[model samples]
Target: MALARRTLTPFGLWVFGAAASAPMVVLAGGIVATYATTRVTALPLTFLLVAGTVAVLAVGYTAMARQLGHPAAYYGILANGLGRGWGVAAGMVALVAYNAIQTSLFGLFGATMAAQLGGAWWVWAGIALAVVGVMGVRAIVLSTRVLAAVLTVSLLIVAAFVLACVGRPAAGGLSWEGFDASGLAVSGIGGAVAFCVAAFMGVDAPGSFVEEAIDRTSVGRATIGGVVVLGGVYALAAWAMGVAVGPGSVAEAAADPAAGLPFAVLERLGGWWVPLAELVLIFAVVTSMLAFHSVVARYVFAMAREGVLPAGLAQTGSAMRVSAPRGGSLTQTGTATVVVGAFALAGADPIGVMFTWLSTLGAMGLLCLLLAASVAAMTAPARVRGPQAGAWEWRLAPALGVLGGSVVLALMVGNVGSLLGAAPGPMYPFFLPAILTATAIVGGVWAGHLRQAKPEVYPGIGRGIPKTHAVPDAINVSI
Candidate 1:
């Protein structure tokens, strides 16, 4: 079946991209950790820096999107710009990175929900996996709505918390310390920047839905909008944290991030919404998981259609041609279930094993993907007829993205122990890169085999472009 084209509006794409960021989780959990590590009152500034970097990358990224009109994310850009072999390698990396992210969320969700609702963590994880699976099989519109609603609630809670902080600032009294660079000179600034960058990881997610956007322009707008919104929201919340507890004492206050320090600040500031905010955070994580689920499914579908995976995995829903990747969704769901169940059976600590290790690995892998994509954006073939970005936007911005992403990747690797919330060890630090390298080698070898044995499918590695099929036209924009 042919996929539908132009089924999603700008707002839907924005929500999907932004929700994948899990703003509330970052505000409530990630920021606190950053603060504890960096002891930097200017954590908000770090967020702005990260956002600005991404915005620059988007200038070139969106330009490429307009030119290529492919919806397979990095794989498409890599294939068209770099080569089929590199694109195949990227596809393998993306699948593993996104799946790691999605599965890692279950650990956080299960632990949080179990703490609040009085149940086994595995029970909560299992339930979430099942629910998200169902949602993943539904129309993209449905998932967008769910994400939009949850994101709205989460943002409102953050807004309320910020207001309370501003109303009752600590001894320093709502200073602009967080904006000053001097305040960021902590012992772990590298780790802090890496985490901040991790928090902005989903800025490119909107591009994955370009095939379904109401207009190709919507993809660019949605991506930029999501980046700005997440950046602004995170900055505000982090600033509020600094204000509420006094910048100097932030590290001490957040010494125990697992204790939900940010929400505790809200409670202390006469904000009676702590419990409600916690609930919103749970929903935020769920929405984030669902968003990543959708991203992974699309990758699977795109690869399947290109013959990198089984073609059956590309099957969409019958009711809507551009609807969900039902087969891919089911496949991801089953994989997550088995992984989560195995951890449960082993009586593992959900937070330590599933959340920390997997999420850190995913974050590092994503950084690598972003770096490759930025290079692709700079070198990709441009369209002769369509709108073209200026030289600075197309060239300089992607160059900067490549530089910045490389630095962050290095920092993440050096601070792998801190990122994983564990002591430094040879295995812990080296495992992720080894795995990524191995996958890339496997994918390249596989692509070479396909080129030799099945030349017809080799060139179409990331071409989720338009053609006649059982899918709807709305979801098949040309590559």
Candidate 2:
């Protein structure tokens, strides 16, 4: 069999990097959850936590990336600093979490479009998943290009919707006066922030292709730049909806922002354009689901290849030649399928239940990964401490990152029960994070002490990691 090429030009890298992060802007179900909170609670505190957390994540990620060098380097550093066991453990959690989220979104895509298509939602979901899976199992360039086309068209449609609503009346159309932040609750504020933070979660994914990024030195810049683009898009989408419909009615409209708000506005401006806007809204969700599914599957493949999970999860597809690890990939697909099946069984609203759970879990996992990464950053390279290290690692940076991530994690975990009302696996709040953290700790202890037993593998732990080059490179990447 011919091996699929692993080549990714610098431009291709940027596109993939941006597309990987694009899902955060579109398919992010967390925004719906946050809107519900704002409508039910206070908006000011929600704004503070949401704004504050992303700002912190941005700083921490940038500083930590400087030391780690590249995406894989970040993972490698975690393995080296925390122990290989921990690296595998963190990688596993990330892999599973990404797939679950992607799969859940698949259900949403199916159900939403099904309603419009006048067919079974699961059928739509199956169709959507099939498309995503095929793309996911193809070359990175192919996947990125498809995602870019979907993303650009989807965005243009939304932009048009927003512009059409500019001068509409408050009663039935655009109403900027309703952007209030007075009703937020302390818990609700934290919850909203947790959800919004999910929008910025995929910025680090492109780093997975560090070995293939056009310019290694540019990885950090590109990653950070992606975050900024995500933030702006999210803010615009939120503001446009918040202003047009008013926070008061966000509840009923929360189910689908693009369709709910933008469609309403379009109906007022040019009634004939309403259907077009709604179609675009549907496509946006589809694009997001496809984008997320591809990246998450890739994550599973990478982790399995590194032995974080069983060997099976890291198996690459014949076409993509970058398939997930064997056991990990199976686990990812299984988890997603189960969730979608359950939603189908419960006859529950796919977008509300499955989407919420996936986004919530994604949020929690993201915080956990950041915390682990930060700790690793702080602990790595202990033997070479000095201004050089201080300037590079920003030990303080990771420390702060941990603190910031911890706060977000705590808020989300604490309210998991409250948010979901104890349905969807009654033990989720306590169990999921415990599983994630425990897995990492166990892996770390195992890897760190393996030197006493498996001495051979121990010595080469840091070798071949994308970030660690014996010679100088342009990406200025470290990990």
Candidate 3:
């Protein structure tokens, strides 16, 4: 079943992108984590710089997305621009990445709520997982409303914090040292940039909803606009954090108790805002999870509809006469439950282990996908990319995007130790790339198998549907 069309506006699309970034969570967890892990106090500058690079990526990304009407953005772009095999690789990576990122939030969600309420971390995560699962199978518009509402409150909290920090600057009045470029010259700045880039990870989400958006162009607007708006929010928040505790002391303050740093700052500077901020942050993470869950369900739906996976996964449920990807949503819910349970059984640190590891892994894979898509956009034929194929957006922007994306990817990978807190070792810090490589290899092999066993379905791997492809009897169920 297809997603409901004409249900999302430019504003709604922007909300999906922004909410997935989880503004409060980013300000609280991500920004402070960057300061502590990277020991870089110029995080405000890092966010601004990363935003510029991400905007470059959006140029080619949106252009490619405009050409394709598929629900799975990265998969369609890769499959159409490159080949069936490459598209399969992109699709597998995307599927794993989005799921990792979505489920990763549960760690933070559980921990935050467990502190607020009386329960084990996983218990709160399970409650949210159930709530998100229900919402995931509802109408797209319904979920968007939830995201928009929660994100609005989160943004307000963000604004409140920014105002309070700027109002009560430490020592010698207000200072601009956080924006100083000289601070970025440190060894671990790449780690700071990587985390900052993660803060904007969801901005590309509008592309995933292109087919559901009221206007395809709105996807472009929302994606690019999200990058700009989020950049400003993050920069301001990071700067405010530095201002609250003199810039030079920002690293020291953040490192003392990194995860609690934002709350401490808020409690000190804003007096009474800490309670509300923490409450909203937990909900903000939920909204973020909902946004990513919605995106993942669509990806599964798109792949299934094309007969790439079990065709039964393409089945739908209805809300307000609009179809929701029921089978896909349920599949994601089940997968998430299993992962969350395993972590809980092992007594993992919700924030340190689950959130830190999986989210970064997701971000890393996505950066690779972005780089590949940029190359695909630059190389695709004029006919395949449609009328505006030869424009600067299709040509120059993607070229620059590839360059910028590659540098960012290199920096991020080079500083993996700081990002993961892994000591000098071969097994720990190297797990992410190894997993991605293994996934790509598996995808390539799967594509080859499909080429021989299901030649009829091969041609339509990335185009959304197949005119002649037959569903495999073993996995295809009539629902």
User: Which residue window of length 10 is worst by lDDT in model 3?
Assistant: 470-479
Better of 1 and 2 by TM-score: 1
Residues 1-479, model 1: lDDT tens digits: 34456667888888888898888988877888788766767788988988877776676666666556665677777787688899899888988888888899999999988888889999999999989998898877677878989988988888888888888888746678888998667667777887887788776788888767768877878888888888988988888887887877778888865545777767855656787888888889999999999888888887887788888998888544456677778989988998899889999899878887778777777778878877887777655114645767567878998887677778778777677676656566678788889988998999999999998999777665656644444553222
Q: What is the TM-score of each candidate against the true structure?
A: 0.94, 0.77, 0.94
Question: Per-residue error at 299 for model 3, in Å?
Answer: 0.5
Model 3, range 1-479, lDDT digits (tens) per residue? 56666677889999999999989988888888788778887888989999999998888888888778677888889888888899888888988999999999999899888888878999999999999999998877778888888999999888888877777788758888778999889987888888887888888898888777668888788999999999999999999988988888888888886436777767755567888887788889999999999888888888888878889998878665676778889999999999999999999999889988899889998889888888888887777777645567788988888888889989988877777777656567778988888898888888899899999888879885333322221121110
> Global lDDT for candidate 3?
0.84
Better of 1 and 3 by lDDT: 3
**Candidate 2: tens digits of C-alpha lDDT, residues 86-155:** 6656665665566655766776677768787778788787776666555555555566666667667656
What lDDT score is found at residue 57 in candidate 2? 52
Question: What CA RMSD would candidate 3 show?
Answer: 4.6
* Model 1 TM-score, 2 decimals: 0.94
Q: Cα deviation in Å at residue 46, candidate 3?
A: 1.0
Give the runs in model 2 whose Cα sits over 4 Å from its true position: 1-33, 40-52, 58-74, 169-187, 247-259, 308-349, 382-393, 421-429, 438-455, 458-479
